[model samples]
Target: MDILSLAKSVGSRVEAPLTDLRTVTKVLGNPHMPLLLALSKGFVEPVYRAAFLASAASSGVLHALAVRPCDLESLAERLRIADEDRPRLKEWLDMGIRLGDLTKREGCYKLRSLPAKALAQPGNDAIAAALEEVLRFHVPALLNAPRMLREGRRFSLDDQDGLVIARSTRVVQPLVEEAIARTLDRDAPVRLLEVGCGSGAYVRYAAELNPRLSALAVDLQQDVADSAAANMAEWGLTDRVETRQADLRTLDAQPQFDLVTLHNNIYYFPEAERVDALRRAHDLLAPGGRLLLTTSCKGGNIGLEALNLWFTYADFGGPLPQADELVDQLRQAGFDDVEATRIVPGEQFHAFTGTSKRVAYA
Candidate 1:
């Protein structure tokens, strides 16, 4: 449906305090307003990223401009963009300029301060990579939602070969790390077992935070496990952490860990298996060992709700369970002192905490 028709349909249903049809007329009369609103409501960034990727010299141009402004010819030559590609390159640069990533003056283009800094900083690389992966992989998968739904089938992540999963998980690592730190114990050494530990970000974060903390990071995908191992090694966490490519359900339940974490990966388990997964996590914990679970609950923020829809449509297990339902499951898993707290209230991100019923003697 067209944007105007959609807006009118929505306006008709909303019970606003309006006396007549004039209200809808007044609202939709301003065509630019609706267009601008839609543009601002999450369409802009992906458009910019798509344009950036379409240009062969986009990255090189950004990097070169980070050092110094360059004219079209100089940029083409410096970036090795061929004559045939220069027109497309210029179009991409123009889009970047319009997006405020670059500034153009007197036939030369220069990177804006923030974009320049992002190009120069190593820390921003992960975020950039994540954005690129999302643009390349996730967006395509999302676009296939209608077809998948019609066919009663789901898109699989296997095509991306684990890159999308790894980068996407890493994108939220900081938030998960902060939530874990706030809820988990920090007084003593922690032996953590992180199920579905993508990229080992949380494991490394915890180990770095507590000098005596050690972790066993597990991912079902061998490639992801290998990548996590490399990431741990790069972070100098190899000595304190181990990576295993194994499914959580198949893992030995030895009650060996002081803390077991299931972050953002809970949706991988089918709705029927969720409680069992929680129970298994409980079993893997030492007596009184804490279980920390994090996910966006159903009916949360628009972004999270959209994610839940994609997961459900793609048959990636199931949508995020409701917060209260998750707490009930934790309790049923024989856990004590179960609680659920919002990490970001409106963002729908939350952390669920529970302690195993058995007490530890140290």
Candidate 2:
């Protein structure tokens, strides 16, 4: 039957069964199939594009293309795809060409689209990392949430690739640097304790802002802490900054730091424990020392929501803070003059500054 006859039959629950592939094929060939496909492509293409680009980025395909045009074998070899997988690699690159992120001339592939070129640039590495984060973490957090909930399985910290997160967090470097500038006493000697010091980038930024600043950068994970330490050494801040692998809660209440900062990691602590965590940070600060905490809070876009979703389901962390609630948390943690500012315009990212109100907790 033709499209109309088949549809009318299906609509009437008549002769044709909806499950028949033959009938479906006739309907797919109908006059309106182009419009149907156009609508479908609008939703499907972006997903496919993101997945392809993210893979290309993480697998060094973007770099391979940017460095030089490469034929299938050469590119596959550069990407270290096994000889047996070369055909699949070729197919993938061909799809990229069709997607407009890559082009082929003669027998070689080159970066074609502006985004591919831009992401390949050294300066735009943070943006590329952010794209990887979206594909790697955010998408799965949302798409698999239902199954995860049903299975009672959550994304543990180890489930995430810390290196990806550390790199991706730099996407918010500008906002974070502003918060640092607001809190740091640039000319004065300052001692800093940075919690969850992902790549030690912020610590480097702060050290640059204050010539007399020395810092102890700490992360809960050994690998992350080691990575930060390596970055600090490479940045030539080894003499000024010390990197440690330690959880904030285990640290002694030193009360020596002039500033304590936590950026983009508040949700790593459960809401029940945040006050205590903040209190630990509070105790680490000297009298008059300021705590600079920055985080992506509630009421943000899908990206932030996905982040919150991960933390919510994780065994160790909690939901993104609501602004007033976090303000109260800092207060409960014994911080005086707590103030929060929207550091990123039209976004839920915030910078909070508060002074230590008392000596280390008894």
Candidate 3:
């Protein structure tokens, strides 16, 4: 159906007058038009190169060029792009130019200003690496959607390495930190417990914000736990934060924490297990303590929705409940004053806060 031509025709018709019902009906009948156009524009070349460039950036090719422009031969040698793959690598570098991640001048390729900064800056580097990890770990599962649905088997994200988790934590920690701050009183001393604490970024941020804050972070994977501990040491938060490798289900239910956080990890649990996990978080909170849950709710963002599709098919990861549904679950788990705020409206990110119903008697 010559999708590109159809896309062009649709683009040309957007402003056309369609007062007549027949004309409106005709325009809307071709539902595939918008889908084709979006796929052609958003997913075809740009997304393909974004994945390639992210990989290059992670493997130090972009960072090397960020230091100085280099010819194809020098770049191949420095990055160890195999001898036979040099030509294909050069083509990818050229594609990076077209993708706006690189610039070519006098037979040399260099990182563009934005890419240079992203490769050089630690925060930006982490985000870039995280994006690469998405392409690596998440994209394959998504591509296998047909098989997953037919087989009813889940993809295991538990096998993803600690570096991916660490990088992913850095990517989202800033927004999560802001959300947590908005929900809690920053001045008060608090004990925090974080489940699925990837790299311990949230714990470190909270403890650094208030000297009175201390935290216990739990991760299921030993490697991830080690990485989180190392990050805590790097941030000088080791004294204030302790990390343990343990499954949330197995963790002892103790009312020790003032703020129990479950961030971006809810979908890891199956539908049946989700409520129990929330109840566990509730149990961990002391009297008057709060349980703060942050995740992308179902719908809203297209990219997130697509990822949720893969997660759903995979079994372990599934669609997140809508904000209202989550609020109801918190209430059912015996939480009080349950409220949810969409931190990024129309983008699926939300923070749900609920208070432990236990009250201290005088």
Candidate 4:
């Protein structure tokens, strides 16, 4: 199938136009890729990491010496470990230093900016703890991908409904948060539309943060749409956000929103379908309205070897556009000032913004 070529093709077209991830028209949603997303980041790993780190701290005296600017000798002395344990501790120190969670100058270690603050705060060793536990989970899922394919069995991380959860953490949450922070005026109302809203996580976060903001969450799955509805109600945002099960290809009834969002959900369709969906989103925008898109290309953090190959074996039916190609498509679709930014440094996900061409009402 020339899997690599196929994956590369799919990754290219899935970026900008097919940003709405609600539809799964092909083998792109194979359980492997998304499973990696879930384990790498989520409440699932964070909660477990917290517990593991807490236990490691109590028994291992290194916690006391992990403070900023602490020397290796001092750290070793604080641990007071048996000679055999030194190698393990050195390896741990080496990993932490590399991940940017810790800094090493000369022979001393210091916390990185974010973790430094978390560590300084009272009763907050959360960062270190979470990192420890999540690593354990990530390793197993990564190694088991080949086994699942060979055995013709589902991966353990696959959702019961057979969807592979995002292999990446809701890492985009922070990006959206930053966007909201910059665009929102204090105490001013905002309206957001998530075109391929899944489970309402983004909407929920938006509603919770900006009491004055309203949201429209749309997904293709009736069950997921219902779940988002229930969540809005549970979160007391029923009056603020509405959930709907509508296909993006046929969505034509909604009012233009202040902002439209498409998370890392594209790539299930062929080239033509992707472009058509993008045109629809472009047409739906009001004057000065912005559309935000998120997608991963071949250059993204998680390797999509399986996904990249699926395009060839599955019959693309159309050619997929890469990052530059998608941007050009957005411009051609009549969107103005199309721009893209890397939401996470060295990560696959990217954020793009385009404004509808403002037409004068004569």
Candidate 5:
């Protein structure tokens, strides 16, 4: 079982006092967990409650509770109850408790710990705020997919700029930079290519690390290319990193990069297209060049299969491939060597770091 499954297996038994302190300590100390907790505190829980209510109501369990453990009357009063509804209040309270959202102890109702944690962030409040925007755009957009399919319309991510900003720089860049920094050869000038370089975050970071680094940033959209160029300019790296608008599937550049990276845009391609894209990425490398790819994989509390399926709404056709499959694909594309590593693991997302085989230039 994965780390998350282990946590779930033990999470219930590990609750409070014994585990709560440990859990909070882990959250406080972990680089990723704090951001997650803050997101949970600020946004995830509220949206989840809304989703839960909708899901439960759709399941027809919205209005039935009697003699709840917590004083339903007081809770209802706090939420603004009517005088007439007070007579049947206890029933409503019992129903809510049974529904697993609230806990009732000694005739008092309170939100459950897990749900309470949904909005109980301490430090990383910005993460929560960003997550709210993500869910606001993603959840309904995915849930409404069936209607879209019937209408023969494709879903678009134009409104997900917040998500793009949150993950690209806020999450992926630091991890990528750290991982790459560990593996880079300090004395040699590295030739880098960043595919789908939305805003040149990777290019700028990589350039900062190696002054002799030369990078090419490619994106299909002119706006994205321009944004990347602007970013590179801000870092005074215009001479070192050049931005170009080009499609990865049809890239015509000479194969000469030491590090070729495809950031978060790997999943947008169809299965066949993904294979072709990977093949193209492999073809672009100088013999020993590394092809680094990152994508979300199945992992934690968040349902991976469900999230993958949700992408279908947007006509996103390829679910992330397993690490083994990806490694095999690299070999088939004529890459000399390949290895995969799980760089980051989230409740629902896992990032894979794929390194290509180093070959001698003929």
Candidate 6:
């Protein structure tokens, strides 16, 4: 059948019997080729570049390149690429050079882009891990949402690396640190209960902020809790802080903590149970204790939006919370003097603080 006849029969996205490639390619040129290519350069190139950056970061290429220039053979050896794969590895590095992220001179490759260098530096590991998260989880969700939903396939904990998540969530550390500082008593002896304490960084910050502060950092994952415990020991905080593998929901509500914190893990609970979760945290607090929470709320950049999309198709977690809704949840959970503040400029990231009213929920 001719093309026009086929279009009439099959409708807009024409699907019919197998046809000749020449029949389609020969008929017409894309009249908007110039605009199309412009948009392609603007949009398409970034996706490829992002994928490249994420891969490079995850594979330690960006860090190695940022440290020093390497000949192709040297880079291959440094990355431990097999002899058979060295040629393809070289080709990939050549693409990085083409993307303007790497420079080659005198048979040596080095980081060329400011982003590549910055992402390779210390304290920016979270940003690099965030890139990895986008590549592994967000991109897959975006590309396969329809098929996944149709097949009833859902994202589960097994699909994601918790260690990478622990690293990536540190992208919001500065905001969370500020919140902790504002809530923590500077000179008083304060007992803290931290939920989902990734890396034990905040506990460290809190300890630094107040010499008399002691903490019990809890995480749902045993390995994470153990790692945090090791870090606490390394930081000379073993005498002050303790790390435990426990869920806040079922944790023994000792009600001895002067302050309680839940950072970046609210979406771990279903929306219906968030209030109850907060109440549980509240129950862990002593009288007149303060509760501080920080999270990337719904509606931000593409990454944050993609993160929300991730949980929408997740079997084990809920979507990112709305700022207003979370505040309401905090209040409903029997927290008094509730206040919410936007921590990151021009982003939906927020910090919420409330005081314990000492109400026990059934």
lDDT of 5 at 357: 60
Candidate 1 deviates by what RMSD?
A: 8.7
* Predicted structure with the largest TM-score when compared to the true one: 2
lDDT of 5 by residue, 112-133 (tens): 5453334333333334333543
Compared with the true structure, model 6 gives a TM-score of: 0.84
TM-scores of all predicted structures: 0.72, 0.88, 0.77, 0.52, 0.59, 0.84
Error of model 5, residue 255, in angstroms: 1.3
- Tell me the lDDT of candidate 2: 0.88
For model 6, the stretches where C-alpha displacement exceeds 4 angstroms are: 1-36, 344-347, 359-362
Name the runs in model 4 displaced over 4 angstroms: 1-172, 179-188, 305-321, 360-362
Q: How much is the lDDT of residue 18 in candidate 3?
A: 48
lDDT of 2 by residue, 58-123 (tens): 788898788888899887777788999999888998899978899999999999999888887878
Among these predicted structures, which one has the highest lDDT?
A: 2
Per-residue error (Å), model 1, residue 61: 5.9
Q: Count the backbone clashes (under 3 Å) in each candidate.
A: 0, 0, 1, 16, 12, 0
Q: What is the lDDT of residue 206 in candidate 5?
A: 75
Report residue 30 deviation for candidate 6 (angstroms).
4.6
Compared with the true structure, the alpha-carbon lDDT of candidate 1 equals: 0.75
Candidate 1 per-residue lDDT over residues 1-362, each given as its tens digit: 77645564655655866566676666667667567557645676556655463332225555567677889999888878899999987887787776667788899997764644474454555565555555655566577877876888775556444645676556666679878888666679889999998778788778767889988899988988998999888898888898879899999657889999998888877787888888899989888789989887898755566567666765457777888888988998889999888877566778889999988676
Where does the lowest 10-residue lDDT sum fall in candidate 4? 158-167
Model-by-model lDDT, in order?
0.75, 0.88, 0.78, 0.59, 0.61, 0.86
Off by over 4 Å in 3: 1-44, 71-108, 112-121, 158-162, 169-174, 344-347
Better of 4 and 6 by lDDT: 6
Q: Write the per-residue lDDT of candidate 3 for residues 1-362, one digit (tens) a residue.
A: 57566565656766886456575466557787678777877878676776866777777887777678899999889888789999998887887776777888999887775654566565476778767767776677677767767887676765456667567546666669888788766788999899999878778777767789988899888888988888888888877888889888889757888999988888888877778888888888889999989887887555566557756765465676778888888898889999888786556788999999999778
